[model samples]
Target: MTLAGCVSTPHPEKNTTAIPVAPEPEPVRPLMYAAMPDERFPIPAVKLDQLDRRFWRREVDYQTSERPGTLIVDTPAKYLYHVTPGGRAMRYGIGVGREGFAWSGRAIVAYKRQWPRWTPPDSMVARQPSLQPYSIANGGMDPGLRNPLGARALYIHEGGKDTLYRLHGTPEAFSIGKAVSSGCIRLINQDVIHLYENVRDGSPIVVVPDPSMSNIAVSSL
Candidate 1:
């Protein structure tokens, strides 16, 4: 009388049946280039449709041996990449210097400012006598929408010296993705504000050489 009472064999209907899963929702991309009325001088929205999509500020896959938080400015490509974790970067379109004026080398973000003053260097004032009023002695141009440094400016320094080169904003949005600045790297006002908020003092930045030039010297701002 072994197990005499009752015995029942149980079996799963089918082990191959898969449970239904909900699909993942698409990532939401914020409109980063929008207007900011809260700013001291209300910032207008960028004309995105007029600008090339490649030049837009966005995160991208960046292949580099450098550590995270490093900034690499690719002169020829007109791209400035702030390296983020996980082999990614926040890339922004930048305006480099024209023919005779260009800067390259590794430096640190010595300091940054919001709505920074624009002091035309003596060399620059010499070239454009009209800028004499904004010379360093005049306490530089007051921070405003019309200011050359735009909404933000990051001072670049190397070997414990101010390189006089800066990563700054420009009211001339069209200047982006072009080589027309005196020497400093320029970003659109909106983009500059975004970058200024992210980068910290002492962050490393490397402005690569422009291969088009015969001699890539680290020039002044």
Candidate 2:
């Protein structure tokens, strides 16, 4: 199926199964004002200027490699590196998994969506029954402040099934360089927009086990 046509599909057999395929939610409109003509957020830009420049610098890098378009995320450094030819990579700052949310493995950008809808996993809903109302059947939440997925989402999958993990955008700019999400990695909205425009579906994504001691050296000025 074409990427654009990969929204939810009904499974008729789901009716008899214990795990009901929850009805797909309605489309959500972004809560933030639309991106302006210049692509800046409608809201005030986050005061990144006050934060440590080293942190921002750590987020991006370039590494030349034989694998062509492979991207790597060094969770310890809170950086995502997009590998380029000739031993260079473009790196971006990222927010990684919290203590219990950390995941390490190989995955692919199975699908991507612009302004994707937010759907809490069934496990989450079970823990917080109050969330049941917001389950996918209720058309999910209108893309707004309450939504956790932010403005863009790149769904990651392994072995041809959704890992339920994602590389998505976040309104909480302060979370960069910190571990404080369910499982997916988060990026600043502006940075995610930049990444979304550059990466394609099915791209190779390798989330390294840990960045602190990993010897994966990347080269770039």
Candidate 3:
């Protein structure tokens, strides 16, 4: 009967230290150079490792007096800018013409085409006889992944005369950052398609000259 009065001793309070939870990390978005299999010819994914990171498509702080929607090609810098509404630009790496082939001027995107024909000029054919098969007289090369013009072509013109130069895609993805022996201004196939979709038929374009070449600049636009 002497149960020790239920041992009236109270139990010790439990520890209640709060534990902190770590915040989740944000997802990393890979660049947009993934393969476009849905395309007519099914463009392959770009070999990003072979190209400089600067050549990748990106929006940059651009100081320009030109209106928005204008396209600016900086020859020496090897960059093309699609002037956005703000003082920014969607810059894309490009392959410029080598030596005497480099040109600078103001022009308009007179027209554009998807999977455009690759027609070598007679002079070009004369320089490279191998291209004779794709000459204008031969009705040009059929559009495809191998075509020099790649997936898209933005024809540039001034005063209604064709510059014969184009902002076009290229199969040679490695040629994006260097001056090439041919073509006016070349972009990656995916970048060119993006540019084509964003640009209008008559958007103004300015090619800033290399200091070693002409004195042209965006201010002249």
Candidate 4:
């Protein structure tokens, strides 16, 4: 029996080849600022490397008492809150005004700038004549190292006039949880970047009075 299932014949032509396909690349996000060296300054010995994340407290389910589009600076808490709808807020750590520079008022953000030029105020220049050379009329200091305004600035105005107060960034990240500014509210460069992304020109700001002083007044009564 030759068998019903037995056949062997040579077939020499068969082709098998694999094809390759490349993957699509991811889109890149543009950076807000180029990487740069830190400016020279008389920096204090604060432990910036050890950031206390606990200093920033957000009540997840709790709504802010403030209203939307209003800025609230809680000096004692060292936090600045931008009230949003539904009781939420965009909170940021800040350096508040020092004792003599503490102030409270309603103001509008008149203008904002990136890598802003800085000129010492005339009064500041008068007290420190060395700064006289850097006054605004003298073209102000060029943008770079040594400008106290840091990376960005938002000028505050009241009654259609500049109040000479500012919300600005600082290289001194360690100052984030302290009251050490001359009169302005100081934010870390990173935090200010976050804030700058959220606000627009002419945003209203309501600086609250220092709680300690308010408490003292209440106790005195």
TM-score for predicted model 1 compared with the true structure: 0.83
lDDT of each residue in 57-120, candidate 1, tens digit only: 9999998987888889999999999999998999999999887778898889999999998998
- In order, what is each prediction's RMSD in angstroms? 16.0, 23.0, 13.9, 16.3
Cand. 3 TM to true fold: 0.82
- lDDT against the true structure, each candidate: 0.86, 0.69, 0.86, 0.68
lDDT of 2 at 134: 80
After superposing candidate 4 on the true structure, give the runs of residues whose Cα lies further than 4 Å from its correct spot.
Answer: 1-50, 56-65, 211-221
lDDT at residue 133 of model 1 (Cα atoms)? 88
Estimate, for each residue in 157-201, the C-alpha lDDT of model 2 and write its tens digit.
Answer: 888888888998776768888877776888777667667877888
TM-score, structure 4 vs. true: 0.70
What local lDDT score does residue 69 receive in model 2, on the 0 to 100 scale?
A: 68
What lDDT tens digits, residue by residue, belong to model 3 across residues 151-180? Answer: 999998888888788999986778988988
Instruction: Give TM per candidate.
Output: 0.83, 0.71, 0.82, 0.70
Q: Note the residue pairs that clash in candidate 1.
A: none
Point out the higher-scoring one by TM-score: 2 or 4: 2
Error of 3 at 41 (Å): 0.4
Off by over 4 Å in 2: 1-43, 49-51, 57-61, 64-66, 211-221
Off by over 4 Å in 3: 1-31, 181-183, 213-221
- The positional error of residue 147 in candidate 4, measured at the CA in angstroms, is 1.6
TM accuracy, model 2 = 0.71
